[model samples]
Target: MSQFIQLHLLTSYPPANLNRDDMGRPKTAKMGGVDRLRISSQSLKRAWRTSEMFKSAIDGHLGTRTKKLGIEIYKKFTEGKVAEKEAIEWAKSIAGVFGKLKGKDSGNADAAEEKETKKKKGKESDKNPLLTLEIEQLAHISPGEWDAVMDLVDKCISEKRAPKLEELELMRKPEKAVDIALFGRMLTKNSRDVSIVEFGEDAACQVSHAISVHPVVIEDDYFTAVDDLNKHEEDAGAAHIGERGFAAALFYTYICINKDLLIENLGDNKKLAAQTISALTETAIKVSPTGMQNSHASRAYASYVLAEKGEQQPRSLSVAFLKPIESRKYDDDSIAAIKKHQENMDKVYGSCADFRYSLNAITGEGTMKELLEFVTK
Candidate 1:
C-alpha cells in the first residue's frame, strides 16, 4: 500500500462569498503577486466533515465536538429524578474526566453574576446551577468514549449514586471516530486526577487553503428588498437595501493523506481507512463552504482532479499557477499548466510520486468513480 496520497483539484464558483473575512467580504490571499479569492482550510474541512455525504458514508464512525457534555449529563441526571445537588456533583465528576472544569474564576462570570442577582432578588436563577460544570474547551469525544460515559451515567442513575473511580476511566484509543482520526484532537488535563488525561492523536491528513488560480477583484452587490404588502401607488421605493461583497474564480485545492497514520489511528482497520478515504475524497470534491450560500447560491464540484499515490515526499502542484492563467481559456490552460509542472518536477526530482490518475471534466478524460477507485484502491 502507498504511504501517502495527494490530491490536486480545480473547482469554479460563480459570484459567491464562499468564505468571508471579518468585514463580511470574500476572503482573499495575495498569490503570484495578485489578489486571489481564498477558502480557508478550516472552512473546507468543516464543510466536508459535516456534509451529508460524509455522515451517510461513515455513519456511526464519527465523533462529537462539544463543550457542553457536563450540561448534557446534568440534565440527563436531573431528568432521571436525581437530586439537584447529587446531579451537579456527579456531572462535575464525570465531566472532569474529559477536561478542566469551569470554575468561578475560569470565565463563568456572567452566569455567576446572574445567579447572584437572582439571589439578591429573592428568586431562583433561571440558569441551570450546574452550568459551571462545563469544561473550559471543546472536547472531541470519540464514539467509544461517549458510549462509556453514557454507560456510567446509566449505572449511576440506576444505583442512585455517583460513578466509582474505576468507572470514570472513559478515555479510549479512537477506533470508530473517523473524523477525529482524520482531523485529530487534543485533550488537556481535567480537574479530577491530573494524571488521568490521555494524550491526543495527531491528524493523519493535511489540507491547504483553496486559492483562485487567476487574479480576482472583490465586487460589491448592492440590492433592495420590496415588502410584499406594500402598494406600488403609495410607495414606489424599496423597503430594504443592503450591500455584500462577492467574487467568482476557479480555485485550486490540495490535500495530502498519510495512509499509514490513518490506518493506525483507526486501529489498523484497513477497510475502514479505505472507506474513510473514499468518503473524504467525494466530500472534498462535492461539498461547498456554507458561507453566504443561501444568498449567493454558489455551489460547485471539482472540474479537474489529479490523484497521486506513493512513498515519495508529497508536494503541492500549486506552483503551476505562479503566473496566473489567462481568462480566455482559463480552465484548459490551468489544466495544461498543472500537467506540465508535474512533468517538469519529475524530470528534476526523478518522479515525486509512484503513480497518478486524473479526472478532467473539461476534456472528459476520467470519471469520478474511476478517480475514487484509483486513490482508495
Candidate 2:
C-alpha cells in the first residue's frame, strides 16, 4: 500500500494596501507597521477554487446535485414562481446583513439558497442534498457584530422596499469582519468560555485574517503581488490577487479530498493515481503572461501549485493550492514554470480512468472516480 497523503486546500488574501506612502514603504507611526500581505479566508478560498481539485472534492460530495444548485435557482426564476422583485429583495436583505451573517449563516447561506430552489422546484428538488450556509466560516464574526448585522438585515427585508442584490453585497464589508464571531466563530460556539480572540495563532488563521481585512493585497514575495482595492482601477494598488471581490471569493469553496479511499480503489493503479495527484497538484494553478496567477516556480515552493495532499494516497483528506492567473502580475520565469506543471496534469488525468475532479462526489457529472456513484443526500 502506498503511504498516506494529505491535501490542505488553502488560499491567502491581503488586507488594504499596507498603508503605504510615496516611497512605497509601509507607513509606520504609533502602533507598528501593518503586515505586508493581508491574507483573508475569502482570498484563500478563491485560490482553492481555481483548483480543479477543490471543485471536484465538493462535486464528489454533491454529485450531479452540484450543477442543480445554480440550475434550480435559474429554473425557478424563469418559472415566474419567485417574483423578481421579491427575489431581489431577498438578496438585498441578505447583503447588508451578510457582513455579520457572513460567519454564522455562511454554511446555511448555501442551504438557504438551495432551499429557495426547492421551493421553486417543489418536492422534486427536496430530496437532493443542497448547499447550506457554512456557519463554521460565518461564525468568525463577533457575536455583538453578528446580532447587530442580522438586526439590520431583518429591517432591510422586513421594512425596506425591494433591495438590490448588488447594493446588499456592498453593505457586508470586511472591515470588522475579523471580530471574534466571524473569523473562526465555530471554535467558540459556547461563547461563555471564549476570550478576546478565541483562536491560537495558526498559520492559516493569521493568513485568513490579513486577507479578510484587505482583499486586494498579495504577498511581496511574489512580483507585483499588490492588487490594491484602494485603486479605482486607476489606483495603482486597487484590489489585487486574493483581494479582488466576489469573483475572487467564489474560488474559496474547495473540498478537502480523502486519499486513502483513492489508493484502495487504485489497486495496481496506485502509481498512476499518485502521478496524477502529483501532476494535478502540480498544475493546481497556472500563471499566464499577464496577471499574478500561479507561477510555475510555485510548484516547488508550495507556490505555483501549492498542494496540501499527502505524498501518499491514504484515506486521509487533503487539498491542492492554486494561484491567480488573471488580473494580477507574474514574472516571465513564473509563467514558464506553470506551463510545465499543467501539461503534466493533462497527461496524468487523461490516463487515469477512475480518478477525476468529481471522483469524490456521488454525482455522475463528477469525472473523478470517487464520486461516480454518490448522489446528493
Provide TM-scores for the models. 0.90, 0.23
For each of the candidates, the C-alpha root-mean-square deviation to the true structure, in angstroms, is 4.3, 19.1
lDDT of 1 by residue, 1-377 (tens): 54999999999999999888999999999988999999999999999999999999999899999999998899889888999889988898888777766552323447668567546433322354655676767888888888888888888999888887766764464475998889988776633364355647799999999999999999999999999988898798999999999999999999999999999999999999999999999999999999988997999999999999999998999999989886778899889999999999999989999889999888889998998898898
Q: What lDDT is reached at residue 148 by model 1? A: 81
Query: What residue runs in model 2 are displaced by over 4 Å at the alpha carbon?
Result: 1-3, 6-42, 51-258, 261-276, 285-377
Supply the global lDDT for candidate 1: 0.87
Against the unseen true structure, what C-alpha lDDT does each candidate score?
A: 0.87, 0.30
lDDT of 2 by residue, 54-104 (tens): 445433211110112222332333354555555433432332232221122
RMSD (Cα, Å) of candidate 1?
4.3
lDDT of 2 at 328: 39
